[model samples]
Target: MADREALINQLAASMGAGGYAQTKYEESRYDPDTGTLYCNGQIITRNTIDLAEGFYKNMQAKCDLKTPEGRQMAAIYQVGIEGISRLRRAEK
Candidate 1:
């Protein structure tokens, strides 16, 4: 589907822009139907998702959420968790 192709292209482009090798991105695969993304022949797994979530929670608990700096740190971790969640939607 067009939407799937578009999502794949967008992901590859983002990864390329982030300094990842274009060849590696090209070799990667995205299955929109299953919402699974594979890079370097390794499938993103639920364990990775859980790790991200746990890391975010740990960071949140360690930070004083009331402080601006702490809130910023939490926001950063939240973004990482969100990105992982989006990439691993099939695991949900």
Candidate 2:
């Protein structure tokens, strides 16, 4: 229970900074027993994380890292992937 709350707080802080509404995080719930997460009453599935990682990899493969724009985009994707990974870890 502590772990779940801590992860929710951390996620709220990080995502709040990224311009997401506070209400969204406030409504987030995690079921440690089932390892499931729900945000705004919607289930967050493993497939979502997998798709984000796939998008990041695809972007990295197609984008030129030498360009500032490419690097910025990569950073955005990386942050998202890291956030999702954190959520997964919290479930465990």
TM-scores for all candidates: the values are 0.50, 0.57
- Model 2: weakest 10-residue lDDT segment is 16-25
Question: Candidate 1 lDDT (Cα, whole model)?
Answer: 0.65
Clashing pairs in 2: none
Mind giving the per-residue lDDT tens digits that candidate 1 earns over 1-92?
97986677678557533322343557865554444456784555455656767888788778878999988998888788787667666445
Model 2 Cα shift for residue 1 (angstroms): 33
lDDT of 1 at 4: 86
Q: How good is model 1 by TM-score?
A: 0.50
Scored against the true structure, residue 27 in model 2 reaches a CA lDDT of 68
Which residue pairs does candidate 1 place in steric collision?
Answer: none
Clash counts per candidate, in order, are: 0, 0
